[model samples]
Target: MARFTTSTLSKYLLQAQVAAQALHTETAPVPPEVHVPLRKQLKDEAKKQKAAGKKKKKNANNQVVDGWELTVGIEIHAQLNTAKKLFSAATTSFNDDPNTRVAFFDLAIPGSQPIFQKETLIPALRAALALNCQVQTVSRFDRKHYFHWDQPSGYQITQYYEPFARDGSITLQARDGIAAEDGDGVMIGIKQVQVEQDTAKTLAQPGGVHWLDFNRVGAPLIEIITLPEIHHPATAAALVRKVQILLSAVDSCVSGMEAGGLRADVNVSVRRGDDPSAPLGQRTEIKNLSSFKAVEDAIIAERDRQIAVLETGGVIEGETRGWSIGSTETRRLRGKEGEVDYRYMPDPDLAPLVIGDDLVSHLRESMGQLPDVEVDVLIKEFELTPKDALSLTALDGGMRVEYFWNVADALAARLGLDRIENLACFQLAANWILHELGRLTSERSEAASEELGFTEDGQCERLPVEQLADILFYLHTRKITAKIAKELLWVVFRGTIPEKYPSVLGAIEEENLWFDELSETEYAELADEAVEGQEDVVRQFVDYKQYPQGKLMFLVGRMIRLGPEERIDPKNAERVMRAALPEKYVPALKASD
Candidate 1:
């Protein structure tokens, strides 16, 4: 055996000391007798450190011993990319005709055996590679026994004693605004990632009736655990967002939160660095947080609850809790279980995964540039802000980023504009997609429930990406006012645009029928016609040199209400109204203009 060097021995001794010191202040039961030797080793390491004139770095945010500092970790369960279930040949598609995709093995019928799919292993390997983790050549699955109505099998197959990968890192950013960057941020570390299977979903209905959908049962999932390095609620949310983006970039993992493709389990604990020897407070595992806002709220609520418990001298018990997003609180669901609680036994049906060089090579080749590297490239090559780059790369849907890039390039070409390649433009696209499009879709969906057939929902649902891009480009070119764009978008949503418009001086042609029905000359004449009918408002405008701002819109509104029959062009209506109005009133008309 090789002799231990002074530095190596010193390092081990210091770690042992820290462990021993931590154990000493515990009010709970003492550790096993085996820890005594570990304590001695730690003392030896501390002495070695002293001799070497070294001091451990202090924590970033220093607080008094009595103050609270949270220790947060996340365990993300991402469904693997596979055509079928892990142990069965049943399809794993979501929202499919229920029970139709299940095989006998998935239903756990008598005498039905489990057989692992080889394609499933490839995604796990690819995920491990994407995470920069050390993949174990001989990882084995174990049985995680549990009893639930949806789980046909008595236990879930998971990796415990030896996981597929161990030790990794992911970096993210915290933005200053909902979609803006201008804030301080830090890097967090990943602990490990393991492959597992998802349980079926339980849907509860009114009248106390519950339904079980086994459509998702036995679907492969990867659980990624992070170190307790996060310091703030916002950072925790941002980290999850980053992970979603990274997973999406890796083609194997779907990154849709709405589709239930990804889920997160957050672990939170509080400790005082000044008293590192003292045991950290009880940890709470927040279960299955599906949204970033919910995760942040849960973290804040858990931290506050933990602080309250400590202030009252009440012992914080370790347990699993469910987050109530509406109430912004966590309710204890069950007691925390140790590894032994699951009775983890090696899975007998599936053989050990023997990772070969070719397998590793194939996975590596499949791995494209990860989000972080791509963000860096965007910043360097396109002169994008760190926040902007992160926003573009952090989109949950894989195609959103690509679509954004395509639109940005198209806009650049159409407008003869530079900096189209900049990530800031991509960030703009992300903001619009996440906020504007999302809000529009949601509002339209609600309206559809009570409204007629030709509603915004129908229009929005049919809105195409190319048309949206064209509208945006038109706005950017200043060819259309914001108001006109909005109207045109509604038109596009409800009607079709012609191939071309008639020349400004030419007789309106059939191709420009929509506009021809609302010709500029006709609109000017309508404004004149409206003046004849609304002489009182027109007299007020001429005498006071200003019409009531309300009346201006009302007049314009009348002309527009005339539709194509009255032949009113909105732009010409505004122009004719301004030209006919007195000088003082013209400014008000211009303001409307």
Candidate 2:
């Protein structure tokens, strides 16, 4: 082999350095990702599992390694998507310039005390109810002392000891857990859900000094703490993702990981599988896991690190660690803080929150339909399977769900809601929105198109909700075949005038796009046209009394292009075809012998 020249070697060195950096950023896989293009695959799989009312069997990588079991509990810091801060009137809008969204209370000026905003309780109660938590009739605020770049007050207001709610649970699928053997799947325990104020953001400076952006200071937060119910990284990631979706569904928070709408701190520990209920070993906290994929990776790396340490007769340390993307391992950041170090105490400035039954009832009544409840209603009223219903109402199925309701309303205007005839319309709408539209929109390749890139949000925005309903209406009425529906949809997707409904109708008529309204006589003409070159088949039919069913259908399919938008009656077309043949070819009934 030829050796590299000095110039080529220099180029090689740069590439090698870059390759090493890329390796450092990604850690060992928990299960070699279930599929590639990480985020979307996990999301799609989660939807499939949720709809099926089941969890996947634990992946082999998810199980214990070297007799060691992983115990994980994730703490979700969900920032409330409210108009103002938790306790201040300053706007929480992300549109403002840096450091502009701040108040006197945020600065921690002397004699400044927080006065509560009553509206914050709306989302708080909604989220608690959604989580199946027991909302406390009364909850108190407390002070947590800590020093950081953002907390100018030297302490944070929170619900430390007696949080706003407790004793809630969310279902998950763990490798080995109490619920797994019971045939109920794994149920992760919720220790508490507390309302608190967030500290300011920090920026790096030229020297050792830090820059504090107080805009985020005193922001409202709901900390959901789990009770060591999760046992695998994938399970933990799925559960946290579900929580984020639930928060968004209820309008409790934005749940955007990059913008810090939601953040998770996953605590990982290990114990021997021989005694599953044994006290867990010392734990390490993987702090601020921003994405679901990151959560899965961090847990696997940290667990492997712990297992390797213990396998060598070394003890696992209880400390805080950060997963470095450039290093692909959990780096020691700082020692973990025990609860006693925070010096939690009651806050005298704010009055204790008293949530009465009337308020709870009002809030519950005002709330929109939750995903689970919506799924049930669709199953019964719409004649959908549990899986179909669950998928339609899933938190990630935002566009589909919204389209379903609005499409129903549009169809109801055309076909009365209570009429039995409208059932066809309802089913058609759901099928298109849930299945066909997704396939069509996702295949669009134009970079500038609305449906160009498939997003992790899992909602397709190819066409306006109303326009889609219109397309479904045509399909429901048998005006178009499933294939032709895509043509009309593409037109709508590309059309500049979204509001001009007549223009959509004009395009269909002008292009002769849909064969839906074609009469029986017209279809026979198409069938006649299809059989034009088949003189041999015609001669055979004239001699033998039989025209092959498969041959006839193949001809019809070729002639009409069998689209979704067409109102095609096959029996009628076949009848016309039989009549078109001469009397000599007509089959004669045999006389009784």
Candidate 3:
């Protein structure tokens, strides 16, 4: 240390005194001469800044967690149901013996060359149109280099630099239970859709030996990539389901997650701020998620984990993870691969794919109504509840939708009605088809389903649509009770209609399967007989504060059962019971009603 001169020491002391005075001035009360408006303005500005800093954010679960935001994106690889493999003449079969379907090109033989299949492009174009993607007239393939037993060629052919389609989006509607708070649908953008080849299946043996199945090698795939704009796990899952519906509607792919026809790779990240323009957080991808529930649960689990790590002052590592179904968590697989690691290069064997404008137009004209469009039509034209419409359309690739339409058309034509006097009947038909028919069909095995004259996808060929419509029409006209209608439905479903009757109405008339309009005196006698043995239940219903209100229906049904030979009107029995009771108990009876 060097000694300081007296002048230098005085200079340092003066600087310290000035800093202390400024600090005191900031902390202490202001003088009376300070303008009140200026002081108020400064306080207001400070409050605004604090409020902006601590703004609330929502997690992937749509729960409020201040200062935390979630981001999610998905990549889907769907196997095309084409006749042949992408670059070979081998037939595509899911159930073929392990390596029997492999072509020489699939094995990377010494002199074999890849011959691109023209059949695969039709489905790819269909998918592009279904997703609202812009198809590229000229697109080429590139080789993605990697070292794995799954790819014997040491590289897989894909579209890296130039993809088949781009700039598409799938809308998740609010009625479909996505973004319900917004009251409108949210649109998830598609980055690109590429045609690529899939890797082989790897089977691990007991002693760590691996078995390779080349049946899936060089199979055609259309990889769809979406932008990192989804903020909720539910939204991400909805996007996946919507893609499945659209692909199936266009007849492009089977879109079966359980059958391994479609695979999803979910990329999830979490950031501290809500500003979308801010740099995205480091993402970890959960690869090869095989189910919709796994897609949702994995995103939620990974997002929470990243948030937890960041809260503890730990940095997130970029890696690939696999979802553990048993533990309900994500386990690390390996470090994430970047573009440089893939070593992508253009494939010199195949020329650029050229699509004509005429083909696109022809395909567009040939396409039928898509699933999303049909969903809206069901809600608007037929007045179906959103839940019921979704349930009907989502089953077996819209097979239920077709069945429902057949019944609806039969009813409308027979009744000579449009939306008039048939809205409730339409809804009743929907309930019968979706609930009763669905449950009945779901209990059958594949063999049993076929025995009932149903296709593999549950399309009915033997069920009489007109007879089912007659049952609903009779119920709507109050000619038959709901119980009788259900019984007739069972008879119709099993093809057990009586031999003498030519039609459903004829059977109902011949068998007298209808209710008798009971007189008031007869209803009174039935109510009195019903109450003779069930006095305790009647008293409890009267004192409903102590007993459940469902006892009233039990008493009513008991009265109806007293006249079991003929179907007596239940409402008449209920009315007689209420009138026979004390007038003071009438209000309690109304409460039960």
Candidate whose lDDT is highest: 3
What's the TM-score of each model vs. the native? 0.65, 0.69, 0.80
Q: How many collisions between residues are there in candidate 2?
A: 18
List clashing residue pairs in candidate 3.
none
Predicted structure 1: clash tally: 4
**Residue-wise lDDT of candidate 1 within 137-238, one digit each (tens)?**
788889999886667778988988888788888655544222222145576777888888888666544455445556677888998988987756667777
Instruction: Please write out the lDDT profile of model 3 over residues 188-259, one tens digit for every residue.
Output: 899999999888776544444455567788999999999998887777877887888788767788557766
lDDT of 2 by residue, 353-385 (tens): 998988877877887777656766786778876
For model 1, what is the alpha-carbon lDDT of residue 27? 36
Give the poorly placed runs of model 1, Cα more than 4 Å off: 1-66, 176-183, 205-211, 337-340, 373-396, 415-474, 490-495, 498-593
lDDT of each: 0.64, 0.69, 0.76
Tell me the alpha-carbon RMSD of every candidate: 17.6, 13.0, 21.7
> Model 3: how large is the Cα RMSD against the reference?
21.7
For candidate 3, the TM-score is 0.80
Query: How would you order the candidates by TM-score, starting with the best?
Result: 3, 2, 1
